[model samples]
Target: MDNIIKANQFIQEGKLEEAAKILNEAIQENPNDTVAYVNFGHLLSIIGEKERAIAFYQKAIEIDQTMATAYYGAGNTYYDQEMFEEAVGMFKEAIANGLVEADAYFMLGLCYYNLGNLPHALANLLTATEKNPTDIDAMFQYGLTLAQTEQVDEAISVLEKVIKLDENHADAYYNLGVAYAFKEDIEKALASFEQALKIQPGHLLAGNGKKQLEALL
Candidate 1:
């Protein structure tokens, strides 16, 4: 346990080799320590040894099927590799094993989104937003998902909330413009697009949107 704590400190300090050495020692001393395995998996992930990270996480899951963190770690590794199908199962397992963090739900929703399962993505993202109402990223993504699923009014409302929470969220304004455009509110859409361009001068989408809306006027 001391070794693991020391290893974690080393990890935080960016002394990865030192952390690895200490973690190896910890694993040698107690091969059955799930905590050590999970920490090692996280270290491997950080170092871009994604396959090794998955192996370590799987080992932890093998020893304790109810290890929520192991499943969550594996889910992240798979997600990083763009293996959304595999990541979906891992995230679902993590949730079933008692990892109900909003982040977990958000990742699960992302996996569903990537896999083109819009209904499920919407459902999970809704849960994620409910779990953490102030999470701007989740709320923003949920707004996009709503628009994708043809919920234009809901998307506008959520995007508005995101803008209220962080006035500099250019993407939120851009998407709000799209939502308003979809609802046939030309002036509101143009105003939203202009606000987005004001916040982010480099926003090509907003620029194009502004030009298109201006042409309509």
Candidate 2:
């Protein structure tokens, strides 16, 4: 439909009001158009009307219970609001309904992390990385999670992989240094922290790490 296409175009152009208007009319004309409901909900969310957006998303799901994207969109909104448990439930439902993106698993990992379920967090985050190897944030979180559980060697291994991916990654280097320090490999830790400083002169963690290493010298 031209209205549907126009609404999407308006959304892309940041004309959320126009998009919402068109989508609302389109849905009224064809109440069964799940895409219209989803697009309208997305536009409402962009315009900061979260409650209205959620209402429309619910309508979309009511029309098509198997609409995985609708579940994902609602889950993302819940996650953004820091409602971790609700987000986890919605994401799990989305996945069960066939939403097979890495993002679903990644968000599940974050929810588990916040809830202090470290082992589950690691498992979900690792699954996320396996699904999308280029997921930088997932790798970083995985490394951090490993460190939290005293798996220093595994943490270092994961962070080192991040370094191989991006040599200038200051945080990865800093974390790697911490992992090495936890392992009592002072020399390697100092070298890693110093390398981080080379990339980011004002890196607070690297600077502190360097000073601590120097104290040992």
Candidate number with greatest TM-score: 1
State TM-scores per candidate.
Answer: 0.97, 0.90
lDDT score, residue 121, model 1? Answer: 95
How would you encode candidate 1's per-residue C-alpha lDDT over 148-185 as one tens digit per residue? 99999888889998988899999999999988988889
Off by over 4 Å in 2: 1-6
| lDDT scores in order | 0.94, 0.88
Q: How much is 134 displaced in model 2, in angstroms?
A: 1.4
How many residue pairs collide in each prediction?
Answer: 0, 0
lDDT of model number 1: 0.94
**lDDT (Cα, 0-100) at 112 in candidate 1:** 99
